[model samples]
Target: MNGRKNVVEVLIFKKEVEADPRFNVIGEVSLEDTDMLDHIGEGIDVKLIPI
Candidate 1:
């Protein structure tokens, strides 16, 4: 992080998955809010803020 501040920003869309400690999951997105996943492989700037 090099002296930078760490923050957690989240965006919810519409799909859901189980969360486990094996992965560094900062939080959970609701099943009804997984639509944001569709943008995963596309090169785009996504800023997430929880609603």
Candidate 2:
């Protein structure tokens, strides 16, 4: 692979998921994250399936 941007699709189970009601600021601020990790990795608990 060359030094280029690569896109990887990840599959996460809906079971192991938790979210904070207060940290939901995605709609409030699009693109940039006023929170940490764009609120995607932050304020959320999830596990990716190991390939």
Candidate 3:
């Protein structure tokens, strides 16, 4: 994982719930874009927080 690149943390807000869930994913942004976007598309909002 040390030699890997394009790691990002994302917060997903699930529908039917009042809060969001945080997830850590290590990989290229493009690789996770669809799933992450779909999570948001399916009523889960995404918020990228700086660390």
Candidates 1 and 2 compared: the better one by TM-score is 1
Best by TM-score: 1
Tens digits of per-residue lDDT for model 1, 1-51: 599877554443244556656556556666676675776653555665667
Q: What is the C-alpha lDDT of each candidate?
A: 0.57, 0.41, 0.45
Residue runs of model 3 more than 4 Å from their true location after superposition: 1-3, 15-51
Candidate 1 vs 3: which has more TM-score:
1
* Over 4 Å off, model 1: 1-23
Which digits, one per residue and each the tens of the lDDT, describe model 3 over residues 1-51?
688777444444332344335534332344445566554554444455543
Higher-scoring candidate on lDDT, 1 or 3:
1
**TM-score for predicted model 3 compared with the true structure:** 0.22
Q: CA shift at 19, candidate 3, in angstroms?
A: 9.7
By TM-score, the candidates rank as 1, 3, 2
Runs in model 2 lying further than 4 Å from the true structure:
1-4, 16-51
